[model samples]
Target: MSYSHLLLALSVVFVWGTNFVVIRWGLDGLPPFLFATLRFAFSALPWLLFIRRPAVPWQKLAAFGMLLGVGQFALLFLAMRADISPGLASLVIQVQVFFTIGLSLLTLGERVRGYQLAGLALAVAGLAVIATHLDATLTVKGLALVLAAAFFWACANMVVKTVGRVDMLGFMVWTSLFAVPPLFALSWWLEGPQAMASGVMHASVGVWACVLWQAIGNTLFGYGVWNWLLARHPAATITPMALLVPVFGMGASALSLGEPLPLWKLAAGALVLCGLVVIVVWPRLRTALLRTNA
Candidate 1:
């Protein structure tokens, strides 16, 4: 990657990393389901007017949207609203990596490598560490919800893999169309109509700004630039930068929200990141070694 492209990747990850903080701000007024409804609504509309839908089955699109918007984000927002801090939410959601691997093994009959198994074990250990340290800030319900969200995120990834390559930006927008109505219905049912009305009426400018940031900055700009980079470079070259997300998430939470980072948290992060390093980097190293030997 060129210096400029490197900066672009960094910017995308930064936006994504800080997005947890943005979600926390937005939840100050709106209920989780309502907040999620508005997020996908704004993400789809206006741009959806201009962007052509990708050439994929409506069922596939709808499935991906539901998995991503409702399964992943709704649960995530709810967890963050009451149970978990943004920093830990960011970290916990990364378990989707392991979930995706497990799903592929079961659903697609893909063989797991030694490194992947090692990575999974390490990540599970990290989760076990987190499970032992629950408190007012990090409740069991919150951890469970986030894990569910991560599972859904992994399911969404499977949908993408099945769909093959298409215009992902367009896919995101159109599928977002499928996500909105269900989310609105869910908000009405669970959060209550009165709460939704009150939230809309009393929403401050800052909260609205956070919502827009989630839609425009995090979704549009972040995914847009990320896909652009992937188009230009190898997946291996660009994807590893995602490891910075939790790092930035934890740092931003500490700086902005004053969320403390105890030794346990640091240890958990190290174990999980080292696992990810083995999964992502070890393959590249092995391939290079094989080429040199050959």
Candidate 2:
């Protein structure tokens, strides 16, 4: 990655990692679904005027909107509201790699590499460690919801790839626009009028800031650079940057929220990082060695 692209990727990790804390703060007054609705609503506003339709078709765009913008964020927001530890939530959501891999195989007939398989194993083992600490109440439903969120995100990834060609920023803006109504409906049906009213009345500036950060910083700026990098470089070169998410997520949680770093979670994180490094970098290293010998 170029220095600028790397910076944008890091910015994404930072914003997304800290987003757990922001969501937690937002939940203080807002009901979960309502907060989500307000979040996307605010996010879609600036882009409503400026963003053009993506080159992708409406069918694919709508599906992408439902899966990614609505399903993923909605389930994730609920999981956070259910009090899943932010650090752990960050860690667990990385399971989207596993889901993405599975979807690619099923949809695109891509083969899962041996290194990816090994990385998946290490990641799963680490997730087991994290799950062992969950309270009984937090165990079944909340975790399931988060996992569902990951699946939705993975499905959205498939949609994006399937669409083949579009401006990623345009896609994001349009999908978010498609996301608003359903989310508002969900809020109304699930959270009701009174809670929404109270939340709107009491919503803090920080909450609005978080919404903006997620919309502009994370979605537009972050994915803009990422899509550009993917366009310019091979997946082999760029995909490894994702391994940084867990690291930044855990670090940000610790630094911002004073969340304790457990030894097991730390160990699992290290393993995941190591596994991803081996998967992403080892092939390049082997090629370099072969060239040197030749």
Model 1, 1-294: lDDT tens digits are: 566877888798788788898899999989999999999999899888999988989999899889988999999999999999998888788777667666766776767767767766776686677668766888889989999998997788677667666787887788888889999999999999999999999999999999888888987677657655655654334544565567678878988899887898788768767766676667778889999999
In candidate 1 the C-alpha lDDT for residue 73 amounts to 93
TM-score of each: 0.85, 0.88
Model 2 lDDT tens row, 19-137:
67766777766788887776666657877698788777888878977886678988988888875767777777777766776767687776766765676566567667766766543
Cα lDDT of all candidates, in order? 0.80, 0.71
Worst 10 residues of 2 by lDDT: 231-240
The clash number for model 1 is 0
Task: Please give the clash total of every predicted structure, in order.
Answer: 0, 0
Please list the residue runs of candidate 1 whose C-alpha ends up more than 4 Å from where it truly belongs after superposition: 1-14, 221-244
